[model samples]
Target: MQDFVAGARSAFLRLASHSASDSARSLWADPSGVRGVLRHRLAGPTSAIAFCVLLGAAALGVGNAAVFLGLAGFVAAQVLIARVLQHLGHRLRPDVGFRVVVVTWPIALGALGAAGWTAVNDYHGEVVSLIGLITAGLVALVEPTGFAIVWAVVAAAAVTTGAAVGGSVTGEALVSTGAIAVGAAFGERLRHVIEAFLGNRRELLEETARIPASRDPFQTAERLLQPLVRWTPVKNPSLVWFTPDGRSVFLAVAGNNLPPHLAAGRELPEARNAYMRRQAEQGPWTSGWTVVDGDEGYTRGVASLGIQAGAYVPLVHEGRLLGLLTAGWSAAGGDHSAMAEYIPALVEVAHAAATALGPGLAELEQRSTASQVVDDVLHGQRYWPVYQPIRRLRDSTLVGFEALTRFDAPVTTQRLFIQAGLVGRLRDLEIATMRAAVMEARHLPEDCWLSANASPGLLVDTDLLASILEPIRQPVIIELSEHEVITDYKPIAAALGRLGPRRSLAVDDAGAGFASLRHILEVRPAHVKLDLGLVQGVATDLTRTALVAGFVRFAHDAEFELVAEGIETQEDLDALTRLGVGLGQGYLLGRPERASAAASNENAPRGGRAMGASRVRSRTARTRSQAGAIAASRTTTPAH
Candidate 1:
């Protein structure tokens, strides 16, 4: 008995479920179902106006108070129903809201039929029939076919029954029923055309809106396939991107139900070969589904994966193919005729995908090219260092040479370093350049010092600095640029100290900003280089002159050498000399040249005299003494 009861309950639930499903399917059968029609912007206002017209007609013609009240109440109910429909339009999905409208709309029309019957019978009035005709026409124009059919049947029956009972105007009742049916058929056709137009328009707008903002090709392809997969019979939508050389392809993204052999990120050499051959033979692959039973490489592979029908659309921009967009169906064997109508839409989506993927692919190609260039440069050691003369301004004697890197490649030196940094090989490149400069510095004159630029992060590593500088015999000055951010300077100071008495720290690009001042106070280097901005117009600009004067005074009091950079004019050079600036480097003094040429004094400044070797030795000793004094003071100062 328990088994029997359980079986009965199960059967009842299944039946109820099937019934609900069937009802829902029937309600949503039309293209723009009841919900879509009612939620349109004009639906509510049109219905309200019709109801008001009916109320006015009844009030003017009908003498029966109860019938007039019934019409007024009906109009009020319609206004309330319009409000509910408006609310549901926003809060509920179209199909779910269709269920609500199906129940409410039919019952409201049935009540109207009843009111019409009462007026015709009791008051001998014909305004009710006219009002019924107007309502029936409105319903046919906007409501679904099934909904219009139900309303037509109810209204015709009401009119026919009234005529038969009154024993008058049977022919008129017949004519009225036929007119409603005709109006319904015409309106349904019009509704189908309108719905199709609106649907296409909305799809186009959505595609246009989403394509521009997308930067990731894989993500954008996935988004483009979503609506297509949901609305069409296609399954397992996937995108395969070609390599930059167009010699290989990989599955970059996929939707659900993808076959194991076609998993994302997997390379497909056979697919790439087949696509290349077809593209060479034909112009481009058009958008359409075809059966996958052929012996071709891609087709056989797809057929083995259980995809009976497939479509491949080439994502082309500027006559170059970047990728392929594909869709497949497992059960569409021997009959894909049903997919013909969707071909145009599929083509539109493929075009949008191509337009969106162009910029992203171009960016990827550029980065790949940049990375390859850096790799070539590093592997081949295709860069060399040139030395620029740093001269004492009063005597125009070469004090030292600053080592700067130059690349043989087309890219600028600064841009090359920046690119290397982006690829996380900045330190490696810096160390390589430093090693090259150290090797070349052996050719320099014995007395002059060598200054080289090093970032703080690299300079702070004592072990690395020792590996490059320990074997060098000449005086070495390691320059730290003030533009670079250094959270702590103690490590750099300690690194220089560990390199023995030959290594001195110099602050580069001083007077550019506040960071330089902080560097001076903290690092207490042996030399300070003035930024070009302060030195370019120092002879004329009072502000610049004042600033250079202050730096000169600070250098005198601090006992460190102040070098003016970029002294282009005689006036600026004279002004720096008058202001007590001891050293300067610029095009006016000497331009950068090969280390061999610079060591031979081939590129020396005009009217300049080289310092005596003894004098150079004495100045180096004094600079070293001052650096030691500054270090001692910093170490002994309290940390207030």
Candidate 2:
């Protein structure tokens, strides 16, 4: 069963075994193979030296050969220590399918000493050669490459000792040590090459398996990571999907360390390699691996036992990269070959997982779209206006229209719009809509102005102004909403500063909030539109009447026009006129008419004391005249 398990079509095992064996023979049959198996070949002179020391020690204590063997053992022990140091430095694991062979130098040396003492006590000359051979074999097991060095050292030591102390030089001993070192070196070299070939072949087979099984790239990453986690603990198991632009974004279905910016519109880090190699779109997926050791047990905790070693496998499905799968060994206790052996399997699983996650990916995209829609709305994407006419207070002559927003698409919920913090967008939208309505209005009175709502944000949104200016050439009245009073008003003020001298501003819904009243005083608008709630019952309430009359008087004193909205009764009109209000707009004055009708009234009537209508027209005319003056000033200003 062991043999079957060892040989059962595993390219890794076969390759490793073959490469080791080949490395042993490469020195003789193919020197180039020596380089391939240099790490494993034991072709060195240390073995020969070990042999020489053993014989010398044996001769010195002819009556106690065991003591000599003990000395030889000490030298062998040193060599094993060297081999261990090399292993730790390289982080290479023991050969695959095998346990870590830790031939401790202390134990081996002790054995050598005991054996030599026994040989001397037995007066056995053969024991001398035996010591040389045992040391050679031990060194071979530890580091096949060290064999030559071991053999050469042992041979010289043994020959010298035999000649000087024993008064005899055994050609056989010299020959044996030499032969073993050379043979082991070549054999291990050959073995190493075959192992590599077999390993590559096994990987090809695994890749093929992955091709059919790839269903969900992300899940495959999880599956690939599972065994790694079991073997080596990781703080977080996350995958990065690299883009061609060197950006590596996380495919974070199972990890918590991902950054929020990644989910927004930020691309992955540019250092990601899959993008550079264009392997993100290729199969036999180019796998990129990187390992990080965090401070204070971040990646080195008790939970992460097998993660001392890490491997990353790139996930590619049908030439498209799904992401990357990384797994590590938490503790320092695994074979390097075993670690390498697992990489192919991980790559396959990642491919499978990515392919399977199609439905989830689609859902994620939908959510992304919804989020974008909300953002675009808030930023005023494609928002614009349509115009409705306002009658003149005195002549009811062709007057400007109230610019209103007609959403291209039905936006049913005002709550949704406001909650999105997009009221600013609506203001800009209203402005654009007004500009468009005026530009398209068939015969807008040449001297009339368009009244449009404005949010404080519009002043700061230079881009929004740029858009409107590209298509608009008429005077514009920017009506400030009550809420705009509290928002950052500087940008709006700055924007207003840029408006042609002729443009004017108004405070809309003036009495609804004290904020609006303050804004009107600060902005010094050409007009103030009293809130419908404030104006509707003004005729009946004396206190309200007194307050409104005060506002009307204030408007006149401040050289500002007053317009009343929502006049439903004759009493409302009569009271407003009595209050000295100028412009009146509501059912009594006339419903808001289309732009075309408002522009071409040849016999427009003169209404009586309609404070709101008069206020609106007066503001409009003043705004247009101001805009014309500003344009004239600009034409005359000296160019920088």
Candidate 3:
């Protein structure tokens, strides 16, 4: 019985809340709203005028023009005054008192009765009951539900009593009183139905006018949360966005005073771990406020910031938790508790913000993950650079070495560069790799130039340019690839010029694109390395042979040494030698190797073999007579 009673009581509270919501949305109090547009009880005065004339005529007859004229004149004057008041109300800013008109409705009823009494004879009790029916119906259209019911009761009893006091010699007043009372009850319900329609229309217009764009969803969500922030005394308000992996969450937006510990990124507060667990198991608290501990336990680390407590509202979509919208306060804990009545409204606002922020969060999460990957690579201690020998084809000598970076992750070379650039860490990675390559020079044979690759943007960077000026045992060759476009030649040329005579610049992948050729002409480097595309099948493919032949001629005339890369087979080597290429590097010549002690000690066969034999492979290269023949042919061959 208690449970049933509690359910019944809860239901009644909902009904009352809903009715109050309807009335508040109705805008009857707002002079610039629908009620204002309708001029508040719009048809009430006009209908009152029509009733007064009819009642006065029925009692006095047309021949009694004196009393009838007075009634008609009074009705006209009231109509004019109502119109004037409506116009003034619209013209003013603070709005005229529209609610005052609801009270005047009873006066209109009394006036109608007076008009009947002044004109009539012997229909006393009958006149009172007639006024009751008209007043009830008219008040339904003119006033809100509560006012309509009260006016109906007052008009019925007042008119009936006045007739009896006049001693019209009729006992009919008793019977007619019941008729007036019943009309009041029905009239109130009729007013509520009419008000509900108007209320719905007002709410629809309000929402449509406020929200215009969702292009910047985070900003839009913040703007949407402002109303709730003002209503609640929150010191900190934030919308947290979950990452794709769900391992981390970034503060999409922060409003007001944010807790120092919470900052901008969070997966979940450790303090709320228990709170969330209970909510997950028992279902969340559907209503009321949850007080966050603001005492020493909560305030421990952030003691200086003085955050007393917090309130978190879950942002749920389709039963999945997307994020939390939180509010922090430095005030009394009971402040948020006092706002328990507004919890549902505040939650509704959180729902709207979370919805707008969904797509925005998705985009941020992907970018944030990419940034995290870059940071992990730099600080992870899992990545290192290895050397691949660049051999001189004439003597098969290890003339130079190019550093190739490797990571434990399976990400491709292109993806690594792209992901690093996404986080603005590409230069940092490039500098790290270049430094590693320079360190390898200590383990290498003397006179072997250490070649390191860099993008065009990194070449002009001050730190990299400064690093290029550092003294080394051998010539340092900087190879900028053709994959990136050289946007400005002047700065790269200027920065490279500062490296002095010991440094050499090589335009890598010369046959890859026009940009590499541009790099050769504008920067006028010491060497040009032909791309794998031209060198891969040069012995068989005529077009590849022609392209390499053209690059060889260009390199010679431009006073730059030519190198052909990707020479995996003997045929490719012979072909490149025939093409007058002096240098090459590929897996066939020497695999990239790590020079660590552990690699050799563990007897990791393939890894150790590569490390120990990296220099021996360069020594084992059989001097090709074809390479000398290619040089002879290059001096003799015609344009073909």
Total clashing pairs for each candidate: 0, 120, 1
- Per-residue lDDT tens digits for candidate 2, residues 203-302, read 5445534433243444444443443333322334555655334456555423343334323233444433434335534432222233334423332332
Worst 10 residues of 1 by lDDT: 631-640
**Candidate 3 lDDT score relative to the true structure:** 0.55
Residue by residue across 131-246, what tens digits does model 1's lDDT show?
55555555555454774666555554555445454534553454345334533443444445445644764575475447563556556666666666555556666666776754
Which portions of model 3 miss their true places by more than 4 Å? Answer: 1-221, 227-238, 243-268, 273-285, 292-322, 325-380, 393-397, 409-417, 455-458, 461-471, 483-486, 511-514, 537-549, 569-575, 595-640
What's the TM-score of every candidate structure? 0.58, 0.38, 0.54
Deviation in Å, model 2, residue 608 alpha carbon:
6.0
Ordered by lDDT, highest first, the candidates read 1, 3, 2
Regarding lDDT, does 1 or 2 come out ahead? 1
Model 1 sits at a Cα RMSD from the real structure of 16.7
Clashing pairs in 3: 294-308
Of models 2 and 3, which has the larger TM-score? 3
Sliding window of 10 residues with minimal summed lDDT for model 3? 631-640
Which ranges of candidate 1 are over 4 A from the true structure?
Answer: 1-233, 239-251, 256-363, 487-494, 511-518, 557-559, 602-640
